[model samples]
Target chain A: MRHLLPRARRGPAFRAAALALALAAVPAAAQEGFGFGEPEAEAAAALPSAGPASGASVGGELSFSIDAFYRAEDEVADLPFEGLAEGVLEFKASGTKVEAFIKLKLSENILGESPEDMLDEAYLRLYLGPHSLEGGLLKLVWGKADSQGPLDVLNPFDLRDLRITETLERKIAEPMLHATFALGDFTKLELAFLPGFEGHRIAAEGPWAPAQVEALELLGIDFEGYLPDTEGLEYAQAGLRFTTSSGPVDWGLQYFYGRLPTPAVVFIPPVSLSLSYDPYHQLGLDAAAVFAGFNLRAEAAANLTEDLEGDDPEVYNPSLLWSLGFDRDLFGGINLNLQGSGSFRLAEEGVGEVAYDIEADTERTRTRVTAILSQKLRNETIEWELRALYGIEDADFYLLPRLAFDVGDAEIEIGAGIFGGDEEGELGQFAESSWARLLLSYEF
Target chain B: MKRLALLAAVLAAGAASLGAQGALGAEEIVRASRDRIQADTVSSRSRMMIVAKDGSATERLVDQYSLDAKEGKRTVIVFQKPASVAGTRFLTVSNPGRDDDRWIFLPSLAKVRRIAGSEGSGSFVGTDFSYDDISSSDREVEEDTHAILREEKLEGKDCWVIESRPKDPSFQYTRMVHWIEKGSCIALKAELYDKKGLLKLLEFSQFKEVQGRITPMATKLSNLQANTSTSIAVEILKYDEKIPAGVFTPRYLETGRPQ
Candidate 1:
């Protein structure tokens, strides 16, 4: 059997640093003493009394799920059944001048796979008059769009499984220092610096691995994935953003210096290939407004990669990316959200670059459109939704339909993913990975 | 006999003139009743109970900060309970001539989103109260024309029954009737009517004096068509608190902290 393998793992020291960053937030919260206050009990005690200006709380959620799939092709060795359990523990505290939050995710596959436990986010914030300073492992969202925005580049994504597509669920937080200063009435200036670097988390040696890796192995070639070195200061990223409001519209201007998280293939002689991340600079603009009962969001960014002239075959070319979308309520309480995004490659005459091309079909402009329709019934206890994504240039599409209902403090959700179109398209590669899922979760 | 007749006619004319003037006084009474409590700032923590049609209810803890700014009234509300909606914040700033500006931050979204002002009639987080109902206490007096319907005794207290019709055709309610306590100027009860007749009923009770100001500590809004009701009982209430100016901005809504 052929397999795609990762050539690197983060060192123990880096793990310790991550642990320390998470642990450091505990003391700030511990000073106030952790209390598991029952929300119902606290709210029932309606007393007119003055309480302390500081407090701490601990809470979490636990969920279990089962997934089943039907295979149509032998893309990879098929195992149709999987079971998993996940938990999230969170600690939060706030004082008159300081606040802290820490959250951790614990997951275990009941099928006997190794557990994947990680810190979701841990941050300490200090308030100084009209300004604030926060530091720790954090996930900073920068764009105004509802999803898949062009300017939301601060965090790397976890793409090990294509089934998980929620924006917050897919983001991988990084260590950073973020500060915001109030600039008059409806304006703010924000600055952020990430001291270390990390890239997207992709699975190795599985049906969920990148399709390129699997196709190359089928043709008698070896594929390897390399993690970027995090020890150097050269990999650090920094950004600045200015946000303000004019009339009913809110807009922001941002500039960032960072490495693109997407992996690019580098051809090694003697029938070898490796994936690497390339450095890039991005200047972006985002705006949001409500017009005639519709919420409209737009974001545009100019990504200047190392291959500005598009002459280097190994490096990805510079591109202009934009997204426009609107959210509105239609036909009673049902909501409809639509977004269209496009990326236009600059100097597209490059010799060796393929976006969705397994057969060397390079397109200068790639467009994708997404739509989501959702409704809540029975006092918001029952939720039904349908989400669709279509790649215009690649002629591929993905559809997800879900139904969720609440019963006695527990929510049960059943969903299915369907993929179709050209086999070489980005989403179509997962045609065989399409699956149905059932999840039951409870929160306290 | 002619002199006696003239006296009766003069008395009748005097009564008609006074009745005509009484109609003009209704607007002032409404203006005074709505603006009864004058405070520079208000901060409070309250428990919201959303009762379903089946009588099962859920509670949500909320913190609210409000201030009368130079531009207009500004208010912020933060949710701290139910786990699912914790850390959700909303900010609304009233504009003089245009529609108000509103923004909301959802923990799941992790960013502040601008919402349209036309959602005034939408339900407030699955509650019976609408977005306009939350800010109805601060509605401008001139927006609606009011008339004194009659004087009646409600719960052994004299109240002026007034009928109000909004000038803006787009208002969620076609007309409303309010029962205002005579001396306190507090609206004890109100019935809102839509195009399809009676829609909802609102009642305010549990009057208390905080910082020498008469405040209602309990409020309930019931949707007649849905057979559901939401009640908010204040756990802690304060008046004229020192709320920072930065607390009303979108930044505070996103961060859940001042500035």
Candidate 2:
């Protein structure tokens, strides 16, 4: 990975080129009609009352936005070992008949030796009276609860982090079909499906004796018997979500299942562990509530798997995770958010007894508390935000502070973080690392 | 003949009483309407329903606005509803005569855009309300002539009926009738006529005191010919904050985000 650095220097330049290409790809009509579905328009138009005699035509809305960040990390342990920069562009248009969205992301490794990966999303949506169909890379959210499993698109302030790992990896670019039927003002049924790749896959292979190689056996077990084959793997996930809002309270519940593929691996002799591919099952729950200026959210997920291979005797290991957070507006634009979560593996097994025993206590727990002081400097422009985060875990502690400035179509920020811990367990020695970063971004 | 004369006298007296105690006087009412039309700073949100003549409806959330008193200068922001735009923000500022300057800060985009403006009366966001309806916050009353039409009770509230005819042919509406509240000086209802003197739009609603000032709390605007309507419900209202003056500047319009 270190040898790939020299070529990575071109990452930013490539991203810039991609951005330019995307901009050029847009039609002239769209560029001219920017800010069509804006909040200001909604606020202005909503000032009027709803009276039976009033004859006002409902208005349409359109908007375009972009955000980017750059960072430099120093000597961070067990973290991405490279300087990072990321950019996201989004566009939306809404009318009485249709709504659409487009988004793209360009990420680069500044310090490492390889080109950064890029993620792009584009989708067109059509509203057909009672149903809607959207195609292209899109973020599909299912569920009604505010803070726990899904339906957390609103209220950015209550988010644990800007990025949610599970959802980010599940973002699919293929075309998807979705439909919704009104059950009532408080309940609706939603169904969606897409044709795409499954989460991950694993394969098996081995070398044997010349003539009888095909008939070889391992520890009285048939090497080729009952082995699963990997091909044309399809990933599918479906769930039912219900949402109801009464006064200031909103709630949601959902259930979903999908297969995940891990990287392929080779097993050695002494530890006789065969690399078998299997789908990991996940169950999740989420919820949130708001009262006055205080808000609370909680979510939990459990991973269930029974065996690594059918012929090989091995016990299944399961993991459970949960997170909780709270937020309050102290005054003005200043706000505070405190969040924490724990990831625990209930069972652990490996190729050898030594490996299995070592993995038994892999349960990890982490907590983070953050404070943000914000000010609306000039109406909607020139917003200044100062933020600080204190993160603590069983192995280490981290302190991070950042400041961001929004200037017209450009945004810039600078920040630094420090990680510290004493060497004790296997994870502690690696956790005693710290780094600082600076970021600058612009959008058009 | 005697009964007819008596009836005319009674109608005249009823009209007189409606005009005398209504919210705003005829001249003052016009002045307030003009003040809103020509307001240098205004911010509000609206829920719009686009209804086709065939009876099809598209409902959505629209954040409309304008900044600065200069002609062709304003800002407008729209939030995507049902998901993304629940708390989205947008802004627009008009440039001289070319087009109104515009910008939108999206949760997805997290930035803004400067859009060119064209045809003030063109459909706004595919709804019946034209760009003119959004920018109408600052029109001068002198641009139109005012006449007391009659007095009547609208939506169960006593109102003063007044008619206005545009002095400029370029004005989108040829005439507008307002039902001003006798006690609050607020326009409780209004009827807009096209150049041919045909009714084109109707507006009516109620007002609530916000921050010590009477302001429209709910309003509905319907395009009669188009057979569609836009409605607004204010979920939150705040006033007289120390909002920086620069927040309304074109530069600010291009970058402001809720902190």
Candidate 3:
């Protein structure tokens, strides 16, 4: 079924003159295949050198990027220049009932710290009738919302580069075992277990460094010394999710038990700082549906932390988090996506004693709105996009405008990120770090 | 065969003296043209070339699998070349009286996303063909009103010039004019008109027999307004293959496995 445009809504003419076309419908008896000459013959010869195999393939990509700060010098001087080179290799092999994939990445930051090489994901899947099992270091997304949804908390984030937002670029894969039981055509039950904990990574001494560190040091406190060890068995996590469809809406319910990915800071009575990871139980519900032409998604979660009664000074209080979003094409092929997310603490009486580097996490109630406007031109060979994030409570905002050109297997992207508003707010904390970047990549 | 009935009808009613019989003959001819090829499942690998107005060109490699299902027709298309889109897959399932259900899987996302059926007007992977054009082959003959415009020789063959106006007023095309070869009952050329007049010209060629079924192995669509065109030529094709039912599911779209 094709998605045909309503006749009355047809856009204006593509151009002026209507040229007569020469139809090439040669008689079958005389010509071999409606012979349209060499063009068609050339395309037929462009096929792969090798024929189809038993589904085993290897491919990779190589990329390089450079960032140039353009903010005022008076503001905290941002990094003069930052460059990165990355290479990725993927191997995939499949069988009738089993499949395996390995993705290896080698990333080198020329202007930063140590270069690292690692396996991004190496997983094996076993198909058993209507159920399947997967294991290895894996990365998974768990929410319906396109943006920051509370239910998508399965993996820790890589916050070292605050300018990145795409989940694929910002997520940190972890070791896990996952299983899915197909209950019906549109229903499934999933179980996931992570044997260890990996917290979000934040830069220690860069333009993107946490603002809380500076604030604590100004008060004569050594912030890093108080960080608690998180390598113990108690930090493991597990979750279960059930997804099904009702009418036109797809919905899911999930429950997870794990330690918070971000640590909470509290002040001790005797002039000391306490930083620790608190265990929590999260119950979430998510749904996605299309109404009219809009794709709508929503997610809500209640996180019950150790400070349920609001009596623990070093633990976080329980909170309710929610996100709602929708995406639709406005007109003339331009698309718009908007999302709003909020977190409301159930009992905030005990959390005021400490300050959070991330302003949204410290408030009793915090709300933020994100929007993305994008357009594709030249039959999708070129794309222009603008993304914005606003902190409703802190009066802070961040804007990112990008343009990309796709040339066969290569792509070139140019973009800039700007931050403004309350300097202490989550996004505004990097107000002086605004910069423009150029990225180029090619895949094979 | 349907082609024989079309020929018989046209011969019984003298071409120049026919009126209402001409319209019925047109519909029968169009139906016969579409029903000429029948298969339980069809699989093919093709190479497509997009030529720009400036004469520059790019190519893509693709694999397509199609089968008839209880719900309707089901298809899966996978991109193999042009690394930027490699590993991407799309699934579409026809739903009789309702809009088709569609989904896409982008390797970067590692998840499946449902696509709104209203995006039919959009280009297919930046090519000259629109999403609607991908499924046009399955459009029912009854969806449009047909009439024989005239009979003429097209490159040495006596062909019927037929005009078809969509029954749905909201269809993208205002009308489509076809040049069908008489003996084979195969549409060799089609002129698709938008509100502004001639919009795109489509030609089918490379007729071949696969598993006792006649099939068109090449297609070219040219956008007159933009002076650009895309040509797809089948490198390999097979009919009536046994494709597992699981290959059409969302799970298969995501995992690339027929589980």
| Predictions in order: lDDT | 0.73, 0.43, 0.71
Best-to-worst lDDT order: 1, 3, 2
Off by over 4 Å in 2: A1-100, A106-119, A141-182, A192-231, A260-278, A307-316, A344-354, A364-393, A422-433, B1-19, B22-259
Tens digits of per-residue lDDT, candidate 3, A96-116, equal 566667666667541133322
Query: Candidate 3: lDDT of A158?
Result: 75
Highest-scoring model, TM-score: 1
TM-score of each: 0.86, 0.47, 0.85
TM-scores (chain A) of the candidates: 0.86, 0.58, 0.82
* Per-candidate RMSD, Å: 8.7, 18.9, 12.5
Between candidates 2 and 3, which one is better according to TM-score? 3
Candidate 1 lDDT tens digits, A1-444: 222222123222335335544544543322221111224335432343433344566678999999988587544456478888988877776766787787777675311342222557778898887888999878889988887688888888877778887888888777899998889878989999987677776665465776766666566664532444654588889999999999999999999998888777664544656666778999999999988879999999999998887877777788999999999888557889999998998867764554332113568788999999998775676789999999998799989999998764578999999988987888877787788899999886
lDDT of 3 at A62: 93
- Candidate 1: regions farther than 4 A off: A1-52, A72-79, A95-97, A110-117, A205-207, A217-230, A268-270, A352-360, B1-24, B167-170
lDDT tens string, model 2, A10-60? 245455445545544543221112122243343332343311111112221
Q: How do the residues B149-180 of candidate 3 rate in per-residue lDDT, one tens digit apiece?
A: 99999878788999999998878899999888
Worst 10 residues of 2 chain A by lDDT: A201-210
Residues B1-259 of candidate 1: C-alpha lDDT, one tens digit per residue? 0110111111111111111224346777777665556667767777888888888888787777777767887877788777777878878787888877888899888889998653667666766766666657556778999989999998997778899999999999999898876765667788999999999988777777677766667878788988888888777666676766777888777765554
